[model samples]
Target: MRDKAKGDGTVKPKVYIAEPVPTFVENYLSEHCDYEKWEQNEKVPRDVLLEKIQDKDGLLNFGSAINEELLEAAPNLKVVSNISVGYDNFDLQAMAKHNVIGTNTPYVLDDTVADLVFALMLSAGRRVCELDSYVKNGEWNAEIGKEHFGLDVHHSTIGIIGMGRIGEAVAKRAKFGFDMDVLYYNRRRKEEAEQKFDATYCDLQTLLKQSDFIVLLTPLTDETYHLIGEKEFSFMKETAIFINASRGKTVDEEALIDALTEKKIFAAGIDTFTQEPIQKDNPLLSLQNVVTLPHIGSATLKTRQQMAMTAAENLVAALQGKTPPNIVRG
Candidate 1:
């Protein structure tokens, strides 16, 4: 259904929201555009989104692929606003070919994601999830001994693979909260991070060998796909704890499974996976040393709401033919 015209008979821009958003964000979008939304909490089905986007001038979603097929289906589409910081789902070349602008919510979730990284680090290092299950299953009847002990995070060396805003947030926690020595590897050295967080910039191999905990926070790109595989794992210390809060494809799933199976690394905390809703038979699930999450890195209510609002603002700005604050350039 089309929205009623304004006082001057000017119709609002048409938009499709493929994911449910906060009421305030809906109200904000309503003020700027005529929108149809997928009301359910679940993601909009691809066919439904394609159909709904047929006449839309803007789209807002999280992790939906804005590829050739979708773009072809939406000849009127001018913008796609992603509610998450990562835009790997975007087919930048296709979007460009279709003359569509893309934007993402960044900075808002930096601290939130950094917190999850630390949670994963601590959970994997201390075997918190494993121990919790052991106690719940009545396996803790006997007094615990050294076998129940776990690695100490305080004063340990933490190597961060990405030195973006979220990585800096993690570094702050490592330095102030745990007094950890921070080492980092990035495409380009961040001098500010080095001085502020007392982080030492090193190559990937050096960081892998020296750090007690290695955290991967890099974005997924052609260059980063399977960046950490068997060869990279071989460089890590046997006592090292690996953490991935970035995209799943950034590390090789098979390689990670082998590393854990062979005890090449002591433990791992995985958030994003190569496949969402990870398959039942995936070997990662069977490993006691691995702590897996359903990719709730920026899932806090406040952060999600903020992201929704930011995305709404971006969609509105782009449709209005103004430059969006966070325009994503390939």
Candidate 2:
């Protein structure tokens, strides 16, 4: 499709949206530029994206790999606006080499995701889902015993890895709502967090050993991929409850399976995973001590709409030769 010329004789850029966006975003795009959107529930096929992007000036992408090959295919592409906080799906170096600016929606879903993290922690720690299954399975004839009792959340020590925005939000809840002792390990000590939550800065080993709950909130990177493996699990208390709301590659999934099977940790609440749409045969599904979700950390309706709008604004800004608010600078 050709760029639509406005009454001012300026050509509006052609944008390709890789996934369906909210109606408001669609309206904005239609009014600002000539655009084509993928309306399927599933991801746009790699072939389809490559073909459609051949003449696009910008791409509104989500969960699609943007690399040298894709960039080379879209010779006129100048910007890629991702509808997610993490751009691990993108190759930053390649984008830079191709002179393609990248943007992501950040901070919009922080509180919503933090809320889900806590929900996972509480559900797993209390065996809420397991007991719900038991009751529904007609196995609640007898009164529950101490053997089936759940762990306590209040007054417990929680160690958080990667004390970023979402992590800090989790800390606030842990400190204010549950009276938890929050210990955090980050690249550097955050004095503000210390003052606000009375959080203690601790080494990973110490945190693992002392904490009743361990929450992984780190981003996935070369230094952090498989950061939590066998050795790290060994450092945890046998009664420790592990929670992973971070990237899947950050944890060694097999090692985690072993830890659970060997009873190294009490239980785990996992959102992200090594593979998305985790296979039905995945062992975690069969384990009673595990609570797994389909990576719905930021799935709230309002948050999703906000993210789509933010992403649309970023794409529009970049296409209009203005700096987007959330540009991913290397």
Candidate 3:
């Protein structure tokens, strides 16, 4: 597809937006490109995106897979701008084969996602959601007893798997906000994090067995797929509360369900799942000791807008033959 010519005979990049963005983002895109957008509340259908992208130079979307099929459909495609930080949706091998650049919004949502992870941890540890329902459903006709008791967050030991930017934020909260002890396991040790948060670097097995709370924040990759499974779960203390604010596929869903069902762990707080908009029949939904959310770790209004803007800037920069700041390399 050829670039659209401006009235002054200059060519403007043609872009397609597969998801709705704030009016401000649209205005920004308008200043740099000739673009078309999906205006509906729901995500643009895959078929429609393939069709619309045929003549586009760049695409801005949330988590669409950028594989050979999509690349072949858009021969002129120069870049794919993902609104979220995780680029697992991108098939880097295929993108590189086609000489396409991929970018994601990072750093912008670290604090917001960290806030949700802590929210999940507190909700699960304190049984806030379960107890709230207990009172509203008239199940708490009298003062609650030991059976309704929940764990405490402050002063507990927290194990963070896959320490990164968000993990550092969580560590800061644990250390100062709650006076909790922090332990972390990552591909590489972060000395800065250890010094800043008084965090102890340890092996995965050690972290799992010793911490009162376990949080998974690893990015999903071939190596990290199902990083935590049955054996890993068995290592945790029976009183441990597990939280997953990262991609769902990083943990084996069936192993998690088994651990929860058999009381291997006290409870869990999950923001992402193996399957999104989780099926009603998923056993996790039926567990009283679990707190679930709809993958909204970075869903705050202000943060989301910033992410969109970052993605837009990346797309515009790549289309203009400049190096985008947040490129995802294979």
Q: Which model scores highest in lDDT?
A: 1
Q: How far is candidate 3 from the true structure (C-alpha RMSD, Å)?
A: 1.3
Q: List the residue pairs that clash in candidate 3.
A: none
Clashing pairs in 1: none
Error of 3 at 256 (Å): 0.7
lDDT of each: 0.95, 0.93, 0.94
lDDT of 2 at 138: 97
Clashing pairs in 2: none
Q: Candidate 1, 318: how far from true, in Å?
A: 0.4
lDDT of 2 at 88: 90
Residue-wise lDDT of candidate 1 within 1-330, one digit each (tens)?
946676778899999998999999999988888899999887788999999999999999898899999999999999999999999999999999989999999989999999999999999999999999999999998888888788999999999999999999999999999999999999999999999998999999999999999999999999999999999999999999999999999999999999999999999999999999899999999999999999999999999999999999999999989999999998
Q: Which ten residues in a row have the lowest lDDT in candidate 3?
A: 1-10
lDDT of 2 by residue, 226-246 (tens): 989999999999999999999
Q: Worst ten-residue run, lDDT, model 2?
A: 1-10
User: In model 2, which regions exceed 4 Å deviation?
Assistant: none
Q: Which candidate do you rate higher for lDDT, 1 or 2? A: 1
Better of 1 and 3 by TM-score: 1
